[model samples]
Target chain A: MATITYREAVVRALAEEMDRDSDVIFFGEDVGKAGGVFKVTPGLYERFGPARVRDTPISENAIVGAGVGAAVTGLRPVIELMFADFAAVTLDQIVNQAAKMRYMSGGQIKVPLTIRAAQGGGAGFASQHSQCCETWFMHAPGLKVVVPSNPADVLGLLKSAIRDDNPVVFLEHKVQYTEKGEVPDHTEHVVPLGVANIVRRGDAVTIVATQRMIGVAQQAADELSGEGITCEIIDPRTLVPLDMATIIRSVQKTGHLVTVEEAVHAGGWGSEVATRVTDEAIWSLEGPVVRVTLGAGIIPFSEPLEHHLIPHKARVIAAVKRTLAV
Target chain B: MSEPLSAAMRQQMLQRMIEIREIEGRIQELFLENVIRGTTHLCDGQEAVSVGMAAVVDAAHGDTVTCTYRGHGHALALGLTMRSMVAEMMGKVSGCCKGKGGSMHLTDMPNGLIGTFAVVGAGLPVTNGAALTAQTKGTGALALGIFGDGTPNIGAWHEAVNLAAVWKLPSIFLCENNLYGEYSPYADTAPVENVADRACAYGIPGVIVDGQDAEAVYAAVKTAADRARAGDGPTLIEAKTYRYRGHSRTDPAAYRPEGELDAWLQRDPINILAARMIADGQITQAAVDGLKAQAATDAQAAIDWALAQPHPPLDAVHEDIWV
Candidate 1:
């Protein structure tokens, strides 16, 4: 195992995949010589050359539409949208063309396409640049949604997403790019989709989270353990094929559930998790499910306001306390 | 100047156009009879553009064609079985897309008709991607994007054209200027009269052709296809034509002015081809009539076959969502 930053892990996975498969290609705005705006795709253009690593014009719709076209014609294209908030610009390509092509073609084609985008707030990128829109894709059928919290999970999940037969919306939190973790040294390591990682095991209350919220939930778990309130922290890496079984099992054992995410609480992924847990394990639950999320409001550019709006360790702890009190 | 097509190729083009016209006519009849439900965007008069372009590109040789929703002509010209297409419209299990993709979403990848997108200008970038795949994989193939006149003004079209031109990708952007973007007149939406003129902005060759004449479309597309295969980058070919029917099944075409439809009808692609075939001493009026009769018979046989096919099973709905 080798310790690496989340950004480095992303580049490592892409480079390793490109080395392993000639069919894999990468493209996006400033992805070539500039090595991406966030430097997550650094040195890929030099290693893979212009043929595989390309810099596309600033057209999100075309970028994603071209990726779908390339994928159906036998190329695994990893397209970057710079930010997840820009998914709105390419909604037709992602929701209509990429997601529905396979099913529409009667399964004659397989779109092994991966769309990588940085999401979530806390970097003061404001509303238009920072939004966790994974739920929008999760609601759409024929799409796989992956949200990796740490460096290791990012590497593993990205590899799996690249190799998967379906189109995957791989979201990486911008704030987590500098966060470091021990990633598997080997190139072949992959974390399969639809499996939740039990980051911390506890029986007092179950805290289910995704993306950066996993780190927040873990911090809350650490604090809750000292207060004699054990919290089981479950990180559901992929949202579409959610590891609901693991979440339900944890909820059954703990009899209390608190879901956390960086996206707004209204119609967010946390609501789905809460609804599912309540529907299936209502009898086992000793309290109502609490969802710790950003309130229904736009993310401001001010650092203090942004921090206040986004879900943090304090919010997770409060949600846990609220659920525990019930 | 483009080389003249042979007598045999002209006859083949005539037959293909006739087949499309007859098939669409039959579909109109079916729609009127209330046999086939749901919406269908038919290309009754703009047959020459699709047939002419399809004649130049060898789909069996890996060339791909992406077209708009009004793509029955494109599908039929690309050699998709009439039975499968009609069955798809009928929503049968034996349809081309297993009844999943109806008339608007018809697709046949083996014959290289990638997809018929309902969204305007949506397939331009997709076609560019196909061209990119061919270029990257060293496949000697070209992609053709067929859309209406209004699409060129959209962001996807401009982006796709610029990308294809910059990358020097092997592609042909064929715009079938049928004089209307659904209900609106083309002149109102576009700044230039000829859609081909817009290609100058992208630094690619642009040419205008008489879409009513099949030979003209074939020659223009052939030149463009040859240029693409020789790694000369993409070309924009604007086929000036007119659609006989309304945009969709529900349209009454009251938006068209008096004498406009009649003026376009005089330049009908099938009639022009039939007249050309007779004047070239390739066939007599009697033979042309015989061919039309044969096409109608063939279309009827396909309709009968599609009618015999069963509806898709309930379990099949759950299938094809993945893999």
Candidate 2:
């Protein structure tokens, strides 16, 4: 095992995969020579050279559309959108082209493309750069959405996302990049899509979270353990092909659920999780399914307001208590 | 007919053009009969540009073309069989995309027709992407995009063209100046007189040709394709053309000037090519009539075959979302 920051794990995944397959190509604005604005892709251009790792102009449509075109033309392209919010500018390319091309071609074409973007609301970069837009991709049919919370999950899941046949949107939480964790030493390590990871096993209440919310729920579970109230935390690694079987089984055991996410409460992914669990395992629930979200609003620019909008351990603890009260 | 097209090349281009016209005519009949529901975009008068492109490129070497939603002509010109074309419009499981892609989204990559985008100027960047593949592999293949005169006003066109120029990808953007973009005339949408003039901003050569003359379009495309193959980067070519029909099946095109359609018809691509061939003694009037008859027969036969095929399975909607 090796201890590394979440940011380094992303760079390692790119290097390892590009080395494994010659078809894997990475390109984005300031990715090469600039090492990306977030400083995640420093040595890639020097190692893979300019042809494989390129620096493109500020053209989001070209970045994604060309990636789809290249993918169908026989290249596994890994494109970067810089910010998750920037996906709005290239919605037609991401939703209409990449998601529909394979199905539109009736299996004649396959878009083995991975789009990686940084998301979340911790650094107080304001509205344009700090929104959780994973729900938009989750709304698309042919896309696979991955939101990993740790270094090991980032490395393993990112490798699987790049190798996946369909278009995968890997949204890396900005706050978690500096966090440290132990990753497996095996170079071949990869976490498959559609599998939920149980961060902590318990029998009291099931807390289903995504991205940064996993860490929040974990802290709350640790504090609740002292009061003899243990909770099971499930991080749904991928949202589209969600591991509902694990979630349903856990809900059956715990008899309760509290879905958490940093995104707006309106049409958020938490509602999707809550809807599925209530429909499939209504008898297993002893209480009403609860959702903990950032109520329909924007991510503020101030640090204090941003933290206020983001769900903290106290909020998760309160949500757990609320679910038990029901 | 012209100095560039040899006897065999002229014959091939004429046959493909006639096939496109007849297939589009049949599509109209089927739409009226409620045999093919929804909407259909026809490319009757703009056949020369699409068919002219097929006369120059070698699809066997991975050369591909991306065209707009009015793409029946492009599908036929790029070597997609009339049976597949008819089957696709009929929504049969035996179609090119297994009835998944209708008339507006014809896609058959093996035959080099990569895609027919329903949205305007949506495929230009895709062409650059395909060109990027050609350049990286050192293959002398070209990726051509066929859009309309008004596409230059969109963000996608500028972004795609700029990226192609900066990367020097082997790409070509062909603007089939069909006089209008949907309901709006090009004059209303674009500030420029010719779409090719916009290419100057990208530091590439811009050429304009008669869209009604097959040989003229062929020569212009050959020049651009050669330049791309030689690593000179992308070129923009505006083919002056007009569509005989409205944008889709819904409108009667009452917006056109009273004599505009008649004037454009006087220089029909089929008649222009046929008249030139006859004057040059390359093809006789009787031979032209015979070719026309054979094209009609082939189109009718394809329609019959397409009618016999079954609709896609009910559960097919869930398939093809993944590999």
Task: Show pairs that collide, candidate 1.
Answer: none
For residues A117-204, write the lDDT of model 2, one tens digit per residue: 9999889799999999999998889999999989999999999999999999999999888999999998898999999999889999
* Per-residue lDDT of candidate 1, residues B77-154 (tens digit): 998989999999999999999999888989999889889998999999999889989999988899999999989878
TM-score of 2: 0.99
RMSD of candidate 2 to the true fold?
Answer: 1.1
Candidate-wise lDDT, in order: 0.91, 0.91
Docking class of 1: high
lDDT tens per residue, model 2, B1-323: 34757878888888789889988998999999989877899999999998888887678998988999999998889889999888888888999999989898899888888899988889998998899888877878999999998789889999999999999999999999999999999989888889988989999999999999999999999889999999999999999999999989997899999999999999999998888888888999999889989999999999999999998998998899887
DockQ for model 1? 0.81
Best DockQ goes to which candidate? 2
Report the lDDT tens digits of candidate 1 across residue range A21-115: 99999999999999999999989998889999999989898799889889989899999999999999989899999999888877777889999
Docking class of 2: high
Chain B TM, cand. 2: 0.98
